[model samples]
Target: MKRTTFLLVFGVILSFSQAQLDTGGEETGGEEEHVELFTTPATKMGAATSDFGYNLFRALASQEAATNVFLAPISVSAALTQLSMGGSEQAQRQLFRALRYHTLQDPQLHNTLKDLLASVRTPGKGLSTAARIYLSRRLRPKQDFFGLVEQQYGVRPKALSGGPKDVTEINNWVSQETGGKVQRLLTKPLPRNSGVNTVSAAYFKGKWVTRFGQSGAMENFQVDGGVPVRIPMMQQDNYPVKMGADSDLSCTIVQIQMQDDVSMFVFLPDEVTSNMTLLEESLTAEFVQDLSMTLLPAQVFLSLPALRLSYSTDLLPLLSDLGLSDWLADTDLDKISTQSAKLASLNHKVAMETVPEGNQYPSAASSAHLSYRVDRPFLYLIRDESSGALLFIGRVVNPKDLMI
Candidate 1:
């Protein structure tokens, strides 16, 4: 039998206060502000990679046992592009092709990656992006690569002397960048042959723009296509939400806005037993884009299960299988230094949660609650509404499994 495929990406953020942005509006926590991006969302590089991401998502989700899966496609691409800057011509071209940018000039790709990084790291969006690049104690990164990373990505490489002591610095930086939500990056130790290695992270969390009230009832969720298990269901009546139908997908699409211009979207098959293969087969970044942009605000009686979970993946084997074998096959990334370097491993980690609005239930706004109810296995998306940057994508086969 063909296994079902659904994709997931997640992150959880505790409240962090900073200087307020100058956008004439208070950001999260009533104090901090994010510096707006240098360019509009329409011109951002994250949008450019959506297609590539869509393809990559499907491939990653197709792996057996990935009943629930999540990965930051933009985060992964951001780090790869940075690494490519110091890679040889063939290596750079291979990287670009894998990300579906085979035709663009290097300058354009670099600029877009730079902007995409800045756009997500803006001060108050409950999202953060950071890159920690390490070089062998014996080798120094080239001055040209150093200057470019600083100028464009606003990050400087920190060289590590041999040993695991630098793990503290790496984890500390990850914690700082993720607001203490992510504590450590490596468990075993740095991968061997990690010449010019980089660790990339994207952490996102936002309270629901339209908060849900605790229904005080246990809802049933299917486990591995088996019997339903009871789980806490967050719900709201008469909430203005966007809803759509993809006849091709046989799934109903719903979009829920979260604070900070971020949105959580769900795609549910019309029936619990419906063939999700059909829905997964029709999936694409462009398809998601059109579905979201086309949803009309309607009074929705929405009910959804609360989610809290963390997941990580070693992307080396997966990426290699996806046609990036050249990078993993003892290939040389000679641009960083004449000394040979190979990306020993590429990993992505995330944490996500959806909680109530400070311990209060919302008063019902309308009578129609049947507009959308997520009762079975489904896919989810967290995205920057303005720039259409996808922050997270995930799937839920068993809601009970998602409870942290």
Candidate 2:
């Protein structure tokens, strides 16, 4: 039996005070406002990696046009960043450029990554990220390289035993790290002459800050071409959300809050059959950050389908399209081992689910008038509000395609 790889990437948001909502046409007693800028290394690194994440998403979306695409961009970046630590200068330059970190200096990049990883893995956040470097038993990695990865990334390199048991061991590790949401990451044995293999995984199980009422009824979800499929849809009246519209992309954006400072931004096209090319091309870390600040607070009737999705794919081809084909074809990881070694494989898997659960009950005092329904294909992203890192990004072409 061929075991399939399971990957998922999604996000959540936290509720905010109505005072923070920019309700247009509101005037308060004139008061001065002060704003503090976040120019920390971790934030800078997050912005850079997020750009790479958007690039990766577009590449995948361009290929799989009407199919669902989900991935943890930060996880993939972490895995490749670790690999670059063991690469020669030339290889390092190529990898860093592909990751959109060419401008960042050394040592600082690694240090910032350490800080960013720590921030995202805070306990009780319902989010976790992990990475590992699997080396062949026959090869001996440099002690300095080994120590840096373990100390900085929090995972020591594991020597592959070159046996069927390696598969079980790797799968078990992935399962444990992802809280059992992702399992059997390695369905087959490691490839022959496998010099280095990297695995990165992220898992999120988010609860809404304001939970929706589930009616236990299936509703018709309009896919491309206006075709409809029945699926469970969660509804909430007077839902408090930060909403905005972008005429350039011809989409309406809504921000939903989940627990633990995570915000899920939904981009819904005006029509069921609207082309997503323009919207997809407009995604970037800066674009999202700027858009978030511009949204106004609104009370509206909201309907969304509960999602449980997992996705897995080889990243070499996608990276190649991003101008890293030469590095993928012939790597120079001289710093990793005395023997010439190249990357054997780079695979990423993620699993995420959003249920109709929340921290508090709905308020009945809502004076909502506007309505927003997610009954069609749309794009979404999960971001860590505190660190400004994108935990997950995906396109939901059809909710019924991968239910549970």
Candidate 3:
């Protein structure tokens, strides 16, 4: 009962407004403790129409925050609910089937991936179609889904067959993919006569297109609001400006538009030190709206101090926060069985290295690389270069983000 309740909550969040029940809310006064369930009908919707490329940026930023390898398939149940395709039960079944196929890497995984392309009804529908086709192809021999996966990540997908012991192959694949940033996850040998795992990865290596002088102006960076750190600060004046709402989160978004139409949105409180949790907890359609309305052009002699950060995290907690707990469960496997068996958990790791590419912007060029090392999670995505439509989404998040 408890597990079912939890899955229910996740289903609501992933499907977005499909459930139409208050699964999340603070109770007030003396009232009966109630469980919320989906009762309202859903409508087929398009991507956020107001914000140009909004979903694209949001998806990319989410991938950046993932410290370890991340893998998650499209929530067919959740997605279908938005499209008004079926009842919650039907959606749930579809989602489960997809999960099962990915987990077990069944040849059926290919067909399942193909079937999903037909039903997806979202903004940039064409892009979603191409992405699904690519993911299905990865399940075939000699067809590498990772290369076709489009999104930038760092992990490989593992097929679930025989038993939960194929950790070695997963680990070796991780080592090769990440260039030795992480290692060793499984505690035992893979079962004999297991099938192959299907995985996807994204790797980034970028430096400031304009390299900052090794010896440059130094200033104090507000590490934790006031906790200052004397760091190398890179100064920029009159850089190309593109602004957007960081409303999807608690922070105000500030973007530095670059060549090739790629840009980075930095998430920080309107005023630094604001509890990040405000943005973290209240992130949703309503919250994103608040931020989007407030975006405006601003001018300043911006100073971005140099800092090197490397960290990794297990995605279970964050995914749970986003209402995506099924991927981490034993029973909620994607219908990816290559044979008759299922899987345990998808695992992964990630790493990034950013440095100066060398230049003075107006005087030169600037660039950066965001690389991911995924050892466990494998489902990933890729979007259209211009339209921001989600092109591909897959899952491989187990025993793959480690260094071989």
Error at 4, model 3, angstroms: 36
lDDT of 2: 0.78
TM-score of each: 0.80, 0.88, 0.44
Report how far residue 40 has shifted in candidate 2, in Å.
Answer: 1.8
Give the Å error, residue 281, model 2.
1.1
Across 193-273, the per-residue lDDT of candidate 3 in tens digits comes to 432222222222333433334333566444332454454545554343223333334333444432232233344443434
**lDDT values for all models:** 0.65, 0.78, 0.30
When sorted by TM-score, best at the front, the candidate numbers are 2, 1, 3
Best by lDDT: 2
Which is superior by TM-score, 1 or 3? 1
Error of 1 at 156 (Å): 2.2
Cα lDDT tens digits for candidate 1, 273-304: 42355565565554555555445455667788
Against the correct fold, how does model 2 do in TM-score? 0.88
Relative to the true structure, candidate 2 has a C-alpha RMSD (angstroms) of 7.6
Of the two candidates 1 and 3, the one with more favorable lDDT, higher being better, is: 1
lDDT of 2 at 1: 11
